[model samples]
Target: MPLNRTTHRPVSTNALGGLYVLGALLALGVVWFAEHWLKLAPCELCLWERRPWWVLLGIGIVTIVLPKRYARFGVFLGLLCLMTSIGLAVLHAGVEHKFWPSPAPECRAPAFHGGSFKDWMSAMPARPNKPCDSPDYLFGLPVSMTELGGLYAAAVFVVALVGSFRMGRSRR
Candidate 1:
């Protein structure tokens, strides 16, 4: 195979798969660390943001296992997953900024009607105690982690989209 003119190296499906896998793993690891070590619990939106990464990770692994001919399909799937992540991140960021209300009810403070305190507490979901609208900063950074995640996912989505097209053209 000829090397790509700009990169000066042969781009293969395995390489793209490895990049996707590594990127997803690293992102997940960072969130996990924050949640565990830093005691920063994820809200409902935060948990939703993680779904695409999990899917992307699985797609990357499957791509690695399949033959090179099937790699483009995996890349395409990864692109979709990344786009989903980006969209979710954007929504979360928007909620955090108070630009609009969150779609998830958990993001808002629970309304206590005429029920007793114990009844009201029991009615609430056990998980997602943290409201989705709250912004979780990254190590004191001005930007919230959700915004940063959107940016990162957008970058990866562009890279994967370009890489998939290049792979398709190169094969022809």
Candidate 2:
């Protein structure tokens, strides 16, 4: 027997939101794992890349709780958030590749303020300092992690946008 569209619409809509949430969470988990388990530190641009994922996750949560009529809008917002992330990742990757200079001054190491050597050492940030121009490889791949993240964000954006449109049409 074939599945009825009427019966399947809610399930499919909810599934889209759930999948987006899961993807965002997984991306964040990988970043965290790289920082803690692998002992890799994130640069300023790398930290910037995380903001859109958090926004996407919030959008996914809103999509899940919204009324059926508003769910498509939520999904559309997620697509926009993912696109923003892709842009940031691409910029980060470009900085790493030396295509252009980094827009953020924090890409360079922090300068010491006027003080004794011990005072400067004590004032230094605890986090490991990795410059934005340096690339962190993944599994022997030539591309940096930021580049891979941009690819992943692009894929998710396409999926969410297509799914949102399809779900909207199905409701008519």
Clashes of each: 0, 0
Per-prediction TM-score, please?
Answer: 0.88, 0.82
| C-alpha lDDT values of all predictions | 0.86, 0.84
Give the CA lDDT, 0 to 100, for residue 65 in model 1.
Answer: 85
RMSD of each: 3.4, 4.4
lDDT of 1: 0.86
The regions of model 2 sitting more than 4 angstroms off are 1-11, 110-128
TM-score of 1: 0.88
**True lDDT of residue 51, candidate 2:** 90
**Clash pairs, model 1 backbone:** none
Best by TM-score: 1
